[model samples]
Target: MEFLAIILAAGKGSRLKSNLSKPLHEVAGYPLITWVSKAAHAAGASTQICVISPDEQQLYRELSHTMKTVIQVAPKGTGDAVRCCLPHIEKLPKDCPILILYADTPLIQADTLRDLANRIEAGTDICLVGFTADDPTG
Candidate 1:
């Protein structure tokens, strides 16, 4: 089955304290978006789609020439960003799998993604990636 990826980068990231799109921010000497996209690519994604805010069009365009992008006129919730890629998803090969991810988590490893894809291929419907808490809150 073909694999497709959608990277959600439309959030306002109010806590970031700058006008730049959060995905454009550098993490370990590379833009957060780059790492996210590369992970998806390494995960066997045939195409990567990124949803960007209207103001971030130029930034998004300069990143990956082969990437598919959708403009989110308003900063909405994650679900809304997924909706923007619906049309593109619909045209994908039937039974094709689409992986959705955020642009902020640059530490995700390729093996992790491959494991997730393997599970999906083994008939799992949905999987959520998470981290274990080091300590319990009081």
Candidate 2:
């Protein structure tokens, strides 16, 4: 199933207290966003778009070979980040499914994404993946 993967990588990750962007941080030798993009691709996402903050020129250069990107001019919230991709989204087919992903959550598996897409194909309008956390604290 062909779908568009919108990887939100614009967060400043202030809590991490690092000089690098959150998504640029390495996880098991690969950048966090790279893992997310790989899972999206393996899940049959024909197109992927990464939403990044204005100062992420290095991130842009790294991702240029894999997918398109849109910049969030301001450090707005998630909604604004997604809005930056509106023009590109408009060009896709109306029935095309869109999968929203977080770059920091690299543990997500491609099989899970494929299952969600399968649900969408089976006529579900939306499929969300979430888990109940015991503490729900950072």
Candidate 3:
């Protein structure tokens, strides 16, 4: 079955207080989106799509060289960004599974995604990628 990994990059990240898109921010010397994209590829995703703010088009193009980019014209809730990508989602084969991911958490590893993909390939209807924090007060 085909798999589409949707990375959400539409947030303005007010908490960050910088001009950069959250995912385009540097993490461990690499752009956060790069790490997320690596995990998506490792998870056996045939294609990767990123939902990003339309105004951030230049940033998106600079950061995500190998993935498909979907423009979300307005900043809204996570659900809204996903809705904006619905057309691309619908164009996929009916059986294809779409994995929704946030672009800021670069620490998520490839093996984590592999496990999710395994479960998905085995017919699981939905899967969420998560991590156990080493410490909450770090």
Candidate 4:
């Protein structure tokens, strides 16, 4: 099935207590958002988009060369974040499967995303990719 991956990176990572953009924070040598975009590409995403806030645009534009970046000017919730991407989503083919992903979960794998899509292909209207976190606290 055709795939479209949307990676959300527009959040304010207040919990991390870092001056850097959260998605720019490195995990295992790569930025968290980069890991997500790579996984999406590996999982067969024909169109990949990484949504970011205006503050992050310059840095991500220089860094995320492979994935397209969409600007979310407002800091509304995820619903609003997804709405900012509708223009891109609408341009895609009707049957294409859109996968929503978060930038913070650097540990998330391509296999897990594929499994979620497979479930949808099999017949489910929707499926979530869940991972068992070893510890709940950051």
Candidate topping lDDT: 2
Pairs of residues at least 3 apart in sequence or in different chains that clash in candidate 1: none
The whole-model lDDT of each prediction reads 0.81, 0.90, 0.80, 0.82
1-138: candidate 3 lDDT, tens digit per residue: 347888888877788888777787888888888898888887678988888887787667775678888888878788888898788888888777777888887877777777776777788988875667789563
Candidate 4: regions farther than 4 A off = none
Give one digit per residue, the lDDT tens place, for model 4 in 1-138: 558888898898889898888988889999888888888888888888888888886557655677778888989878888888899999987767788999888878888888777777776788886766689675
Question: With candidate 3 superimposed using the best TM-score fit, by how many Å does residue 91's alpha carbon deviate from the native?
Answer: 2.5
lDDT score for residue 71 of model 2? 92
Candidate 2 residue spans exceeding 4 A from truth? none
Error at 76, model 2, angstroms: 2.7
**Which residue pairs of candidate 4 clash?**
none
lDDT of 2 by residue, 10-94 (tens): 8878999987888989999999999999999999999999998888888888888889999999987888988899999999998
What's every prediction's RMSD, in angstroms?
Answer: 2.7, 1.4, 2.3, 1.7
- Expressed as tens digits, the lDDT of each residue in 21-94 for candidate 1 is 78888888998988988888888888889888887865677665858888777877888898999899888876
In terms of TM-score, the best-performing candidate is 2
Q: Against the hidden reference, what TM-scores do the models get? A: 0.86, 0.92, 0.84, 0.89
Candidate 3 vs. true structure, TM-score: 0.84
C-alpha positional error of residue 90 in candidate 3 after TM-score superposition, expressed in Å: 2.0
